[model samples]
Target: MTEAEMLMEEKLRKKKEEEEEMWAEYLEQRKKQRAKEEEELRKLKERQAKRKLQRAEQESKMNEYKRKQEEQRIREMEEKKSREAEAKRKRLEEAEKKRQAMQAAKEKREQEPVKPNFVISKREGDEMGSALGSSGLDKFANIMYARGEMGKTKEQMEEDKKAILSFRVKPLEIEGLTVEQLRDMAKKLWEKVVALESDKYDLEERQKRQDYDLKELAERQRQINRSRALKKGLDPEALQGKHPPKIQVSSKYERRLDRRSFEDKRELYDGGLEAMTDAEMEKMWEDKMNSFKEQSRGQLPKWDPENPKNKQVSHIRRLEEEDDDEELVPVFEPPKPEPPKPAAPPPKPAQQQEEEEEEEEEEEEEEEEEEEEEEEEEEEEEEEEEEEEEEEE
Candidate 1:
């Protein structure tokens, strides 16, 4: 042990011895007090007996009985006093024990922490300088404790000391102040508190929002990647704030197959689930062959190049109103023209109608003449038939 440890042990030993001597003195004092109380109690009993004897001889039996009851009450009072003294002694003993415990703890606390040791040369003639020592574990504990202390201005340091010395509890200053003034002060303080609280809340909310935005963007990038791991979280329909993806992210294999089919001008296999339609394959081929393509190499398919039943889920909105953050604008459509009415036929001339009537009369006269000719021919035939019949008979 060093000199400090030896000195500390010697001090603790002396302290313990002094406490033992004090305890012994207290016990002696308690003993003397008990002895004095006993002597007084014996005298009190002797006086009470003497009074009872006097009262019994000079008064009635009833008076003597009352005196006896008074002596009994006095004895009970003495007993109570003795019990109180005993309780007090126990309390003192407990207090002494606590004091001893506290002293022991104080001594333990006095064993100062091992500060960095400063070593000086012990030699009489040596010009060696002193060096600071390093206790490995606690080396950093004392560092930075006085880092900025040396940089403090003298005025500021003196003001700090003055404030420490002047600090004292004082009564509230309300001697001449109106209730209105107090209310106004309270209102101002409350408003200041609310403003501070609001500022703190806003700062916290901004930090939280920033963190959320960063995480969301990273999550979106991850989803857009062709990794199979992130395919499960690519739910575009579940509102993700601001703009959502309009196309589905194709997997690595899907993109590769699409590129292969585009380059080869044919599907990889015939009649399978992974096969693309002729139109879709042709579109992909066109996109691939476009040498001036502005899109990146990590391009997502606008429409599902493979069959509709593929794992790639498309979220392309058919209407502008379907966008998450955009307002729908109205589209203008021209009204259709009505069909034209049919033109009316012109009126016929009067001279053409008169000519038509004259022709009809001529046609009636020709029909009558032909009918008379037919009747004459029928009569002639009948006469010739009768003559032939007579000759035959």
Candidate 2:
């Protein structure tokens, strides 16, 4: 072996060992840097987690505060509603009380009687008592008893006995009153009650009397209706209407003519007269006569206005009437009828005269014919008889 080859191999081996040792040292430094990076990452993660937990706690506190505020608002609203309800109830109760009070006052006023302004003096009361008869005095005593100024009646005593028997405690022993005092108090109460009963009885009797009077009045009215129906020529038994027969008074009482115009007034004398009953027309005529008498008191003068001698006086009176604003009515006379025309002679009984004349003519003709026939018959008989005689000779 050459000595240079051995030496170069040894140097190569030494260089390889140095390279391995440097590589191992660099690996150890890398491991240490990785461990430090892991530690810093863990610390940063812990800081982020702590910040998130703090934010969650703050949000929960805000939610809790809002919930409490809402609950308090709801409580205040409920209290306000209750206060309003209580105020309304009180107002309604007060209104009802006022209404009841007014009703009670009205009832009290109606139950009480009217009082006179002046009071009776003691002397006047004594005089009135002295003037009363026995019956009037008894009535006066009843009034006094009702006013609590008199004694008890028999019915009142009976009522007092009943009241005493119904009591739980004896009135004589109550309130440390004596037996005589209790009796007196009971008598006074009984007298008041009896007076009230007497007043009720009087009212009942008065009502019965009023009903009887009403019945009598109704019967009298019925009788009057029957009499009126008879006078009016109407049948009372056949009447079906509630009202009485119509009995119209004359127009004189009604004064219907006072409402008539002059043209309408003329209808009374014309066709309107036919519509009036005989009694009404007669009454109207009587009224007219009375009105005429009243109106003609100083209407006409003694002298006629148409006379020649009274012309000057009439003219002066007319001037005065004109000055007095009065209208003068002119008088009219009825016209005389024309003389009657000469009448023609009355016609004779022509048919009867003609029959009489015809009978006389027939009698004359029969007499003439009888005379001629007899002459003829006599001539013929003589001629025959003469012939026979001749024959016999």
Candidate 3:
């Protein structure tokens, strides 16, 4: 071979060997990079799987929360519905109970017995006939019906009449009541009638007095006005005393007899006294008078039972006495008489009699001696005790 051919071959061999080494190194590097990339991808896939698992768990928890909330809402709704139903039931029950109570009351009223009218002889036969034309008979009938002595309908009247007739009538007997009781009742009735008459008279007198006072006041006012005009240099003949007649209006005047505090009086006054009726005014006056009397009674001095005037009074006399402390004499009580003893039995036989006589004599002697000594000793002890008490005092 030529030297150039040998050198060319050697150079080609060296280039080939270098190319093989480089290819081997590139393959090893490519293998190492592929293993690193596969490892990173695996780690990323594991992270993504973990994230998906977490998201799934979160979604499950959210679903559970929503479900629990829905259940709670449903329970609340049920409870509210139940409460409303219970309230409605209670209201219905209450209404039913009230309705039943009213029905029972109505039934009781319907079943109640009514009084019967006992017809008496008329004062005048034609009195009702005269009243009929004036509508007074109808009013009286209505009053009778209201008193249950009459009925509105014919059927009701018949029923009432039948029911009243069924009861056995007995004669009213006046008994048991004492003469004193009757007299007291009569006296009370008489006093009531007299009081009513007196009250009526007092009212009339008060009205007349008020009218006279008002007239006098008006006259005085006119005179005052006339004097004022004269003083002002107006002609006496031309200037009339009367300007205009004053309109009289009913008014109430309160006199505080108890002297209540200013605040209390103001409170009472502020409540408005303009609308009080005559009766109301009278009642207020009575109440005030009673309060005054009560206060006066409380302030009154206490009575001394040790006083001579009260000495004869009984233990309970203080309770019965009036607030004025008047002297009250007690009623005297007579002493009760002792009952008489029965007569003695007949004397016994001689031996028993002898023994009895001996016993009697002995008892008589002991009694006689006992009486003298007891009397003397009692008197001495009494005197000594009195002296000792006085000395101690």
List clash counts for every candidate, in order. Answer: 0, 0, 0
When superposed on Cα atoms, how far off is each prediction in RMSD?
A: 53.8, 53.5, 47.6
| TM values, all candidates | 0.16, 0.23, 0.28
Model 3, span 274-296: residue lDDT tens: 54576698999999999999988
Scored by CA lDDT, what does every candidate get? Answer: 0.67, 0.73, 0.72
Clash count, candidate 3: 0
TM-score of 1: 0.16
Output candidate 1 Cα RMSD: 53.8
Ranking by lDDT: 2, 3, 1
Clashing pairs in model 2? none
lDDT of 1: 0.67
Instruction: In angstroms, give how far residue 224 of model 2 lies from its true place.
Output: 53
Q: Name the weakest run of 10 consecutive residues (lDDT summed) in model 2.
A: 163-172
After superposition, which runs of candidate 3 have C-alpha atoms over 4 Å from their true positions?
107-393
